[model samples]
Target: MVTLLEHCRIGPPSAAAEVSLPVTFFDMIWLYFHPIQRLLFYEFSCSNSHFLETIVPNLKASLSLTLKHFTPLAGNLVHPLIGSSKPVFQYKPGDSVSLTTAEANEAFDFNYLTGNQPRDSDDFYGFVPELPPEKIELDSKIIPLLALQVTLFPNAGICIGFTNHHSIGDASSIVGFIKAWSSVTKFVGDEQFLSGNSLPFYDRSVIKDPSGLATKFWNQMSIFKIESLPLNFPTNKVRATYILLESDIKKLKDLVIFKRPTLVHASSFTVTTAYVWTCLVKATAATTGDETDGEGTEYFAFAVDARRRLNPPAPPTYFGNCLGLVYTESTHEQLKGNDGFLIAAELIGELISKKVNNKEEILKDAENWISYFGELLNERISGVAGSPKFDLYDIDYGWGNPKKFESVSIDGDGSMSLCKSREFEGGLEIGLSLSKPKMDAFAPIFFGGLHADDSMPINPKENF
Candidate 1:
């Protein structure tokens, strides 16, 4: 059980009225109604009275100061009544972000928090905030852009969780916000220190839509009337974190090269994604009691950052959504076969190479990509979320670096979150969600595959 200690609203330290900012083409793609929640857990080996006396007060104050610049985070998102008009993010005076402070009834050890293995899915939900959509009336309803919750585990630890609407911003923007908050929290008295930090760049005009992909994207999404997801915790679901050492990644790449010597550009991202894809499918087959040579289909998808991929790239600080959903399809047999990892690697490698090198290609096919994702919306698909490049672990809020960081929302989408290893240098950490039975079957295969020898069977690459 989780006990809500208090509920309050945190607004900017000062009043500011900002214009109704237009949502960019990139933002329009993700206007679908959903809250993306993530959490950072911190453990302090001190008395409960010490934690509440010292940390809570500073955390609340710094959060308020942080909101001074991040007013949009405290604001709400609004859409036009006309179907053709794109939605805009609006910040009204006196508006603020909802914050809740809570205490958990269950006790979990630091090993459970720090270990890279599965935990009871229910254990973490107490930390997540309920980001309810706003509904003033039939036409003029406002959806809260962000909400936060901080939970105390007595003397054991504390967890800071945030829930934000995807339409408000992408992962980068969210991380940027956290970094700013942490900076402010660290240098609470130094206004100059806060001024020197990176502020959010909210100029949506920088996004150009020559292909009219925004309208196409919005229309594609509008076709499907998605119901708001319930606030229920997942049942019988388990989450685990696994680390792939830098050496392991290199070995995997080398193994791929040994099989396909000409594949020089096979990357760490490609091989790691391929390895996960193969493991997931095999695990799925085993958990569900599917035959070894099952004939159905499986799919893998991931978001591609288009900030630099576009023709005239958006600024590094350009806020709002700037990701394109990219996915590949495969047969169950192909992915579960002996050459599964190799085949998966080639497909992922070729696609990534094209995306990174041939920027114009994605721009040209932006419309098609939107349509393609629409079709997959109702299908059973698995994909990857979060990236090691984001440096999620570095988000330190005064006390120390977070003991663990989780993209909790990904559990709903059945996708894995990838981050750089916290303990091991040059290693990749994967966050996975599966039913207990599947996880029981998955652990051995996942770990054993890491130690598997070279000389696995191969299937020739057909697409590349």
Candidate 2:
């Protein structure tokens, strides 16, 4: 059980003028999707009184100061229900982000909850706060963009969780806000160091939709059920974290190169994702006996940051979503074959190479994005959330680096989360949510494949 301590309304340091940021085509892709949720656990032993006295005040103050720069986070997404005006992120003087403080009972184990082993997915719901209830005003539905929760495990530690509307921003934009918040907290709310270093560029015009993709995407949103709050994830699922050490990643990359001598773009991201994708496919097949016929099509989708890929590249500090989707597909048989990893790697590498090298055609499939993604929702698809480039572990509010970081949104869709490993340099962390049986089947295949000699062919069934 968790006890609600207090609900604080955190806003900017002082009243600021109203601001509105236009939702671009990039943002429309996720306009009605479930909000992204994440949890960062830090180990700090202190009494409840000390926590409320020192930690709570510092976090609240630092967050308020951080909000002065990221005003949209404390704002709302205004979507006209009866008209053609695209959604806009609007911030008014009195707007603030909801910050909920809660205390978990002693029954909850901080260490077990932060471990890499499979844990009940429901265990995390307590740490995630709900977005402010949506409001309808003058034909426009107002949706809160972000909500936060700071949960204390008594004498154990603290877990900070946040849920944000995906339309408000992508990983890059949100991670920037986190880094800034941590910086201010570490310096006791001194934002002087963030002036030019991490200040976000809120100019929405940097994202150009010359092809009128914004209108096309908005039209597509009409078919989606836009929820005021994030949809609840189903139960009977367990979340687990896996790591690909530097050496493990190198082994996978070497195998890909050895199999496909001419292949290009076998970066750590591509190879690691491919290996995990293959394992997931086989693990699912092993448990359900579905797709074992080998003729079914399997899909893998991920997003690429378009900040630098744009025609007139936007600054890395540019706020909002600037992403391009990269979707790939192959036969289940091909992915389950002896050379499955190589095949998956080649397909991903080829597409990534094409996407990155030819920015002019990045949105060639923009018009079909909604339909394409919608179709895969109920299909044999595996998408990815987060990215290793975010370096999430480096985020610290003077409590030392996070003992564990989790992208909880992946539970909504069987998507995986990728980030830099907290303990291993040059390695990657992969988080997955699967049923207990599938997780049971996945563990051996994932770890066994890595331990298998690289010179030998990888057989998922044999690994199991």
Candidate 3:
């Protein structure tokens, strides 16, 4: 159902500007990893003439200019010799990015794009472009850092897909690039379009690894032969987006507070994460028990952005990964019990509070924790990806905001993606990945917990 229209190279619209930047400690953490990919679908019922004549050209041209500022993106991640050192981000005069254009055979379905119902993962793959392989050099390996695809669904809509090397930057850096590109597209002729914008800071020295956690991270990565991300081929797994409205979040918060009055920092992130973790655990228990005993350990891992949390805070524009992971544990029996909700919330809250209050201590200990965290992730750990803070729906690229935004790659990693509700009401959108059987069991439990009466007392026997 997807047809490729064209595959073209988009280099810096300007003359070749050769540049070489050292991959700092923070950047090294993501080396040898598959690039992160995301897709944004937008429904535009405009005439084909308007789209081809106006939108397409404008988008491609604007992206070219945007890359001029984000020069590193137009380059590659080059690995040094075997006996040499770590990889470095290299940009030569002839460096460029691949941009593919495609067309869908059928009309776009609004419901299918944004619905909560589970759908086949294969439905999304066609829109995503493949990540290019490394261009072998005698002394080094050159890997393309970014690839983009734009697909049109005829009189229905258009989808913009982005695939970027994780080592180039984190979510903040990627999102910033998209925002900048959109800004340029909006004001195509305005020379001042990028004047007031937040330019990317390519210098990775801002992220100070006092404990040399980056080297530890690299050593551990070398220990495992990590796999590449899945292309939009076919998948047996399914994905769905669930929304938690403001009212529903309030009730959940109130429920947790009532059960454990001593709980602190029961914010939206903590509470919502707890609810999802509990549902997954209960669902897994109902179908295929991952644990040998009725009481198995369940881990909840969440990524914390260390930009502002660092002792010598990193610049908002600082490029590369500046994130720390926090993994908390709970037991299946504890989560399935009536008081399980509060128990999970307390653990998540306490960790956040500690990280916020004791940034120095946490950063100091991150080196030792890197290997341990990686091992936990290798297990049955449920972590979160994408933050509501990104406000994905707000991405207006000439054509209005995206109709649906999803972190499609989360499927292979078994992590959930969170985004702010598009309705403007304070809410959260969670993109969860699970087998069909597990999803069926999780749906009712998740909905029922939300609709539970406010005055309902914590009954230990009810859940048991």
Candidate 4:
């Protein structure tokens, strides 16, 4: 029998046992490929400025738990079944180091699900798995896998990498888990290990029992992408900015109320997505030779979460394909003709609330969207040329809160933007991706809205 305080005591144990469970081929595949599907990823490198320090290592005794200790904990969400479910661990770990580099050497292989071959062959589950420690420039790179380096620069000058893979968890869960991991670090004192006994409720699958309610929302899903390659990136790096401020949000709220006279309330995501789409439309249009007018090239993607909408709403933890897409279409000419920004914003909000609040559509959407992804990547349609996926607004890390936020881990092929709320302030943070050529054209449009307030700097490009 397990006791409360007895189990509450934390730290490494003398010994451990084994655990394992079976996972569906489908879930495993999903976890690896679209690891950061609905999440925001950023790519940032350390600066060459001053500031130096060294990490004092506890170069003492140690015990390293490998696949064995994790043996018994398999077959569910916890066990990312990429490798065999066998459990193993060692009495000691090998070369420990400080300051690990966190950059991926390759672009993401996006065509996993639809293609063929053995189920496990397309595996991509686990994260970069190496969490290296870092110190100021004074010290040399030493840490093992956790080779991470961060330095704060004055005037919004710091690059950060934020990676949230879909398999390990969602954006919400990603931050939550990171906090948990941080608390267990040696620097934090008596480390706390979330015991392997914490069993997960693995029955949260939407496709288990599909009904008419899940069938109706099929047509609502559309793939979101932006035209690309018109410009190339310098040094092969993908970078972006995402922010959302209180004042701007209020303005958006007021605009939504004025335009959608029928709706009692408009969700923030809906309104924001509309504005983002509008910006993308305008930016693409401006790049066009007036004659083309941003035709066939302006489209945006929004998510339709399928939790509270089904006949019987999903469980509180139903975290699988609970998301589908809502696509919007317009040329720069059409979007700019009227108060398209406001109109589009209001429409986006309603589209979100309507589809998310409805269940019948989500299930059908999941099935069809997966199928559509198959067609697009299959090269049947020219869809994958360069898709710009905009992730949700993310801003919940619990320390005193971050001084700055950035998306650092995107396969950053074309352009993907993530919107973030500014820390301890009133303004917004927007993370946007652009082709090298397009960056010059896009920067002015983004700063124009945020810097509208005179007290704010005239140009944030240097800071951004």
| Per-residue lDDT over 188-301 for candidate 3, one digit per residue giving the tens place of the 0 to 100 score | 842645576588877666767667665666676666423445534456768887888776778778877887677777789989898888888878877776453556678888
Best by TM-score: 2
Candidate 3 lDDT (Cα, 0 to 1): 0.77
Give the range of the ten consecutive residues with the poorest summed lDDT in model 4.
1-10
lDDT of 4 by residue, 1-464 (tens): 11111101111233443222222222322332322322222222223232122111210111122111221211123321234332111112122212212222223322221121112211221112223222322222211111222222222222222233343333333343333333333333323434523222334443344343222222221232221222222334334454455555666676678767776446555555566556655565566644553344355454444445655665544423344445544555666545766666655555555655556544444545444443333221111111122112232211223333333333333324344443425444444444444455556665575455454334353325
Measured by TM-score, how close is model 1 to the native structure? 0.92
Could you tell me how far off, in angstroms, the CA of residue 317 lies in candidate 1 after the best superposition?
Answer: 1.2
Write the residue-wise lDDT of candidate 1 on 166-284 in tens digits: 88888888888888788778777537435765667777767887767777766776664332355465557888887777777888898888887766468878898899889888898
Question: Cα lDDT of all candidates, in order?
Answer: 0.76, 0.86, 0.77, 0.36
In candidate 2 the C-alpha lDDT for residue 208 amounts to: 79
Higher-ranked by TM-score: 1 or 4: 1
Error of 1 at 238 (Å): 0.5
Q: How well does each candidate superpose onto the true structure, as a TM-score?
A: 0.92, 0.95, 0.92, 0.56
Candidate 4 regions with alpha-carbon error over 4 angstroms: 1-165, 186-207, 211-242, 263-265, 291-297, 304-322, 374-400, 411-416, 424-427, 449-464
